[model samples]
Target: MNRTDDISNLFSRFGASADSYLEFGSQFDYKEKPLALVPATPAPEPVVDIAKPVIKHCDTPLAEAATDRVPASSPVHASQSTAPLRHLLAEVARARQAEAQARNEEALRQALPHGRPAKTRAHVIALISAKGGVGKSTLASALATALRLEGGQTLAIDLDPQNALQHHLGAEPDVAGMGNASLNGENWKPLLLAGSAGSLLLPYGAMSEDERRTLERYLDNDRYWLAGQLANMGLGENDVVILDTPPGRTAYLDQALMVADQVLVVATADAACFVTLDQTERLLSERVAMGQAPLCSYVINQFDSARQFCRDMHEVFKRRLGSSLIGVVALDHAIGEALAYGQNPLLEAMSSPACQDMLLLSDTLKTQLKSMDVAESYAS
Candidate 1:
């Protein structure tokens, strides 16, 4: 028998259907079409047929395949579906940012005295002069002591490279100070020395010529260097900080002006100071924008009432400066005496005219600061 006939007889003996048996040399035809590889470019808008199943590579990860699937019959496009979610997320991020800012401001207000805001905290008074030997450092130190005695937290900072403010404050001259600490990458808080009447003194410290030049270069490059330093000192809102700068235009003076809440220009009743007023005013005008200058005033230091020339110059200053002339410090022997003895004249010689004038001047300054704070509070 033929092999196909023998296979059919075997299938019939096993009870198989006739259609199930095939001839050995006959071919079987498949009705389904073969799968082709994915084309390089797909149709812009391809319709999907769910009834037909497409075979893909077995190496494709299940997670990737699931993520890539998007039904063609979906009402919303992918971009359109995600747009509202992205906008909502952005709005939530902004709300969190605003909340964080509000918390910081509230914490600042709590840390300050008398509920003062951050803008008015730590009142900075910078003492400057048009020429050397104008008692700028002396006035700065004395003012700090006077303010401290008047029940205000006070700090005196010497920005002058001369480093003479510490001596006036009865601090040791050769001790390490701000410049030394800055050069050595040390904290300035440890350098703060005790001063007369419980005030704090920050000396410029001892520095070599090259070191001084380096510091000047730093100040010149960073306009906000001094300001940033002061902010990091953790001063109370009502605390007073007095900056003693070198006379005339300097990088130190520029930095002091950048942070000073009040500018106290020291001038002796003389031709040098008088002649330099225009130049000093011009420098100040250039440093700060118009209508935003700090509260600036003049104090005539070493005014000798006994001399007609001094009296005439004092009158000229009054005429020239008008209400900007804040006070006059008489040329009292007590001031020089206090310096020689390393004592504060306001504390040592309360009966002296200079002491009385300083007390009055400090009170006047306190009043001005109070007024400023009130105005700012109202404006805010």
Candidate 2:
């Protein structure tokens, strides 16, 4: 047998019902001669006379004698009354088979348009505060909630060892709470907020003395590393990553700043905080000049226009931060209440006037980040 036959035999052994006729080409009989097919049961004698050579005819001849088997009108055979039903059933079956074949063939060539590119170039945004108790976690949670509900995929990463965003949001640090979550390539549970938008939080996972030390050893370079780790967390297009950092000048903060594509310092509108912003910018600028940092800005938190301190602080911040200052996140009662009640004011308190301000801030931030991404893509 040729290779074609061998392949057919192999397929046949595998119960594939191989069509061997394809190898040699198909055969067809065009003559309209009636061939008497005997029943599956063995006949007592030969039905066709062997002496009569097999005749190939274009038309069938009718039997002449009464003794001869002459077919009656409408072909009154053994299966008589079932004639019309059999013909109808056969036609329906043939049409159905043809339809199925056509559908399968059409499916093979179907493909839709490609997806939209990422709206933001660097997915990570690390939120920092000059000092504690100024609502760093609050703003982080609120921004996360706002961005997610605005049809952006968002993941809030709590980098604070204190875990304030955890308690404020009434969510046990999901990564830690589960105890099973790990960076060691284990199954992790996402802290999904009880809301409509696709927002999530990855609490600093439960770490032992050993894990903490290991994490700390890697902390010096965790800024860019955190971005890589987050991408590995199965995020998608238009996704915004919000990092809630520890309140200090710790190396953790540095890592966050360096990794951040956009850094928003959530500071209160006060002299002390504004001075801290100067120190922060100076630090970032030094590192940026050394080619060790990324782009960033300041988002002055709790700015009340009615208060003189807040109004004056804004001016000082703009002057101190200069063009690096993207926008200010004004003080909002809804934001405080949302944090007090462990909720994201942006999504829930959207109708609140205070929440509207936060929304504006979120929009401005998103716009800035998207523009940065577009510029990067263009440069590339």
Candidate 3:
């Protein structure tokens, strides 16, 4: 029996009609049915034509030809291009304005007079250090040399008992300095030694323990003793007197502060230096509060930027000092070499990095003096 005859027999046995199965199978046409359902692929996106037409020069009216060739969107494109040009023009205008401001500032600086008034006394600078062996004397000498080189009469007074400042100024090691003059009741002006490049040097001179004690007593007895002596020297308004004080707290430091118009504290970029500076600041705060202390700033000498520890300390100092940290002298062998040879580093190594730092310091001092003069003039 075939499968169709068996299906018809099964349907007859079940009491269902065979015509119903035939009708269900006939609903779907087998030959005409789709083999598989396939979706149509989407059409490709249309490309935008950004290429602009190039217009050539014509003998006829160019405006008429440009209107014909230009597209409707060209106006928007032109506006977009003009935005960058407008920004460039604005930048150029700002640059020109900045240049004009700078020129005006320079002109004002030039118009200001140089040096203090004749009625005003000489500007006094005191160089102090918290610790010994920090190159304070060398800096004092260099600064005086720099000022003298700028055509200002500069006098360097070595208050340190070591009398080592003269050595840096190319003076004889055994020469008697101001300390000797004070002991013998001789005028200090006669003891003033002419230094290299028209600078003046007054050494501390060799002193015995008793003589040193006597000088300290004199400074203690009179607060303005040093100031009086300086005045007797008859310094001109354009003259600058630099006092190199001994390291740490001393009567000499007090005398220097008594006569100084400005104080420059010298320190190195080290933990010990910072600790000493903290102590010094405490000592100075009382004087500053009383208005007895001179205007003070800091100088970081022998600064080595390559050392990470030094750089960290420098940042700390910057935070502590802010604008009062006025100068930094990079560590350079040239400075040591010049000192060893008993030569002024500012002149001996004029092209060295250390010399450049000295020049910057000198310039800062000059500007400060000028500002003070201007302020005084206004006050008067």
| Highest-scoring model, lDDT | 1
List the RMSD of every prediction in angstroms: 21.5, 31.4, 24.5
Go through the candidates in order and give each one's C-alpha lDDT: 0.81, 0.65, 0.80
What is the Å distance of residue 15 in model 2 from its true position?
99
Could you give candidate 1's per-residue lDDT for residues 123-164 as a string of tens digits?
Answer: 999999878998888788888887742345788999998999
Better of 1 and 3 by TM-score: 1
Highest TM-score among the candidates is held by which one? 1
Tell me the tens digit of each residue's lDDT in model 2 across 47-97: 787887766663534644443444454355466656677789999999999
What TM-score would candidate 3 get against the native?
Answer: 0.66
Q: Cα deviation in Å at residue 359, candidate 1? A: 1.3
Residue 12 miss distance in model 1 (angstroms) = 99
Model 3 has an lDDT value of 0.80
- Candidate with the larger TM-score of 2 and 3: 3
Q: Which pairs of residues have clashing backbones in candidate 1?
A: none
